[model samples]
Target: MNLLDVRKRSLGVSFNTEGQADIYVWSPIAKKVALVLPDKNKTISLAKEDMGYWHTSTTDIKPGDLYKIVLDDDLERPDPASLAQPEGVHGPSQAIDVNTFKWTDSNWNNIPLEDYILYELHTGTFTPEGTFASMEQKLDYLKELGVNAIEIMPVAQFPGSRNWGYDGVLPFATQNSYGGAEGLQHLVDACHQKGIAVILDVVYNHMGPEGNYLNDFGPYFTDKYNTPWGPALNFDDAGCDGVRKYFTENLLMWFRDFHIDAVRMDAVHAIKDFSATHILREMKMCVNELMQQTGRTHYMIVELDLNDTRFINPLEEQGFGMDAQWVDEFHHALRVTAGGDRNGYYSDFTGLQHLAKAYTDAYVYDGQYSPHRDKIFGIKAENNPGKQFIVFSQNHDQVGNRMLGERTSQLSSFEMQKLMAGAVMVSPFLPMLFMGEEYSEPNPFLYFVSHTDPELAEAVRKGRKAEFAAFHAQGEAPDPMAEDTFNESKLQWELLNQDPHQTMFRYYQTLIRLRKELPALRQLNRKQVEVVPNEEQQTLVLHRWHDNDHVVCVMNFSKTAQQVSLPSYSDSLTKVLDSAAPEWKGPAASPDQADSTSAVTVQPESIIIYTNHA
Candidate 1:
């Protein structure tokens, strides 16, 4: 058999000379592997030794070549690293040179974390057209709405045209429904051109339960521990080096090859790796090194529920060294203030103190004793010193977990909703928004999947029911695979013209602009936060402050209007944002010019942002 040529400028595979291919695949089931080039080029096959290392190459294969492999003549498969999967998941792989895709973002410095008012959006549901090209048209509008970064849900190839994308099985292949990798590239290019950063939400902890063929390759996963989806990855096992590299390399690819500015590592705490050092740490160092080389500030952020501060601290200091972590405290506090209900994890956060803690400390549970977890959960985020925690009043999980998938908007009045938006944007920690939240789009962001396997599809539907039933909160979970779920999730573009929706959008935009312009609000110092908690009044106020140049953040959580007297301000200040001033009053509201500080009455369901005018 003639040997097929394999060479890459990438870190993974390389074959420098003809007839000497350095071929590597994860396939373990195959006893013999042969690389087959089309057009009767030759019967060149690679030699195999030391666990799936198929080598030996010839000049038969060249750039722009199409190829498939005879896996022990048992199964014919496509190249794992195929740059183009024109034939879909079950078809032949098209090899293309990565160097040829012209990048227009040579000068793109990543948007900083502090600057990111993240918009977490699901692509397939983001627009009626449901394509990246269609989505690109809306970039200007999002830009106008003050979205600096777009945190897109996962886009790797899954089974069908519709999915929330967590069901992705082919990590290398972009979902065909979204116009594949090219479509994503167009979106990235458009975002870069518009000075908007793109952060992909990647799931590497566990593969989707269906259409997963990694096990056919080798011990990609082990039964040592089980994830809700499937088996956990075998990161520490003997043959796990390549597996770890595969995942890490893919992450770097998102930054390097695709020009993605950042990655929102999904549920990183679920990523169990017990190497001498942590895999996450290694991944961070690797990406940071790449950023240094490219002169860009690509970041690795994580979504960890572990409440472990170590995830955000430096490696030497014994933390995970992530650029940032989502502070659930912010979400919890905001939820309690807006919704006034405590169940599930919300059980830990009840009343105004929790909301105040979230306002002051960024994490409501920071260093607090918790009855929910039984043991103490974490140290105050202030201990981290100089970092920004991401806060959101409503995110995908909180809304979708409901049996009815009702939005926070559904549970509150127009005034209350506006007030919640104010509390979210004006806080010390950096802020984020779920898509459709700013406009208060009256649509539900439910979990949706399109699995080809009927049995697998049924399981997803049933699992949704069971999970929500355990909560015992609401009945009738949205069928993620249903056409209605996808249809219902799309933003009602018409809502922008509605009074309350338009008002809220403008209000949100104002808060974001103020956040950018305010010197005091720009401070990422978690330690500098001060909370004045009022349990009896159900009022929580905090100062995300610079003493000499001060800013005051006040929140009112009651359903009805209540006037409260507060202590005088430290410095002469003007009211910068009143969430209840009809609409879009951020930066426009002025404190009564009588005194710099005084006992003032706050209306019910209002948030006041006072900025020093001195």
Candidate 2:
């Protein structure tokens, strides 16, 4: 039975029957369980069951009742099934009637996976105000730029004022410093009011080093498995049923209670689950049930490093039901092409060939031998994937985790920078941009966290430096624990008026318009994308096809000027956007591309998109 459908809602209680009221509090560790209604001064001792679930049928307990679980008559705490945390995590759990909030999106439907253009932004760093309402102010800008969804970094409560938001300690509560819970609701309502979907990033594997008090209650973590963060959840151990409920409840809380449309589960591989039905599978099942309950289609995305296709594959085919995953192949290839650093995974990717292959095929090392890992990596996804695949040129991890926390534009030439923007928008995969990427804001996007403990802070500081040193020989690394790290990570919003920044901004907006308007560029559930390489030159041609119409993309990846010979096709090519063109004022100077130098005299770096005229 759905407990939410019951009439009366009280703290530290559950229904005895469909129509009867009963107060319940299970204290396995407590010698005696007492349900104290502080409002009425009514005290009732529950008869503890063999399973330790304390229960009592009391007619006095009614809806909107306020009570707390008295643990051995010493400490009282919020209910584990708290629907609302009006007073934050350490306060009372309000009994919220699920059907109370008046939702306005009755006929609203989310855009298909293939049709998504995501803009990933951290709420705290996006604006000076650093709240949900602050980002809400930019809805018109996103709509104008053609971004359909805003993928926000984790908003769950961590420690202190500023953070990356990934190491969320309280899974159910919104960050108090970032305008708290009511403010977040306002943001979601505002986003839906405008035509945008909101995707939240959630970490289920491990909690922050501090403020994570789940262990104080029971065996929420286990030593059987370990994660980089503090402890792996006890998903397979004894008394693990409640652990599963904790995560599943958090998932439903986001979608149903917070009105969040989608969630990006952080690090699925880190979750240690040996259950018959895995945690990921259970999550998908719970989400499916929520969809049936709410009559809304919500999406669950996985951020996996395993590079397994079973995530998006069908359940009958022995796959986890993930809507999509972040494809690092495309991101790595594009980064190396633009930044030209082969320190880490970039070692596997070098020239324009890999970049071309990545844009053409989503994976560059698909089941291929790898020298970096000394093992074969990635599966051959030559066949079609039903779920959508998300890709971005530069994201928080790529830019922030760097040895100096440098952005692409900080290192690449202006010409190359604009080409990167052009390349990102025209690509077939679902494109996402980290905040300030559109206007080329020079924010560092560095990794920042607030740990009050001195020892933990020092460990994080030393760990970050050592991690980078392991990958590269020598480089100036940012101080992970310094105040400057957070200060530098904030977006410099006024850069919109700058010359090259404005030009690139317009280029991004134009490409977004094209992605939304063009049918060929839209994501259709199939593998209809193709990449044609110029074997001898640093150029690649890409094509995305619909029924009869086709969208063509050409990329120039050299440091010097060169001629690129055009292919002889029946359809005349209409240049839709040219990064090296004068309107964008690109530095490229390719006079003609069809010459035998069969050459298109291309500048140092550029990308060109043209419409096919049949």
**Which candidate tops TM-score?**
1
Best by lDDT: 1
- Give the lDDT of residue 510 in candidate 2: 84
> Against the correct fold, how does model 2 do in TM-score?
0.87
Over 21-72, each residue of candidate 2 has an lDDT whose tens digit, in order, gives: 5655434566777667778898767777654456777676665666655667
**TM-score of every candidate relative to the true structure:** 0.91, 0.87
Instruction: Write down the lDDT of every candidate, Cα atoms only.
Output: 0.72, 0.72
Cα lDDT for residue 121, candidate 1: 86
Q: What is the lDDT of residue 581 in candidate 2?
A: 77
Which pairs clash in the backbone of model 1?
2-44, 2-45, 19-57, 19-58, 20-57, 21-57, 28-217, 310-320, 575-591
TM-score of 1: 0.91
Q: Check candidate 2 and list the clashing pairs.
A: 9-63, 563-599, 563-600, 564-599, 564-600, 590-601, 593-600, 595-598, 595-599
List the lowest-lDDT window of 10 residues for candidate 2.
Answer: 1-10
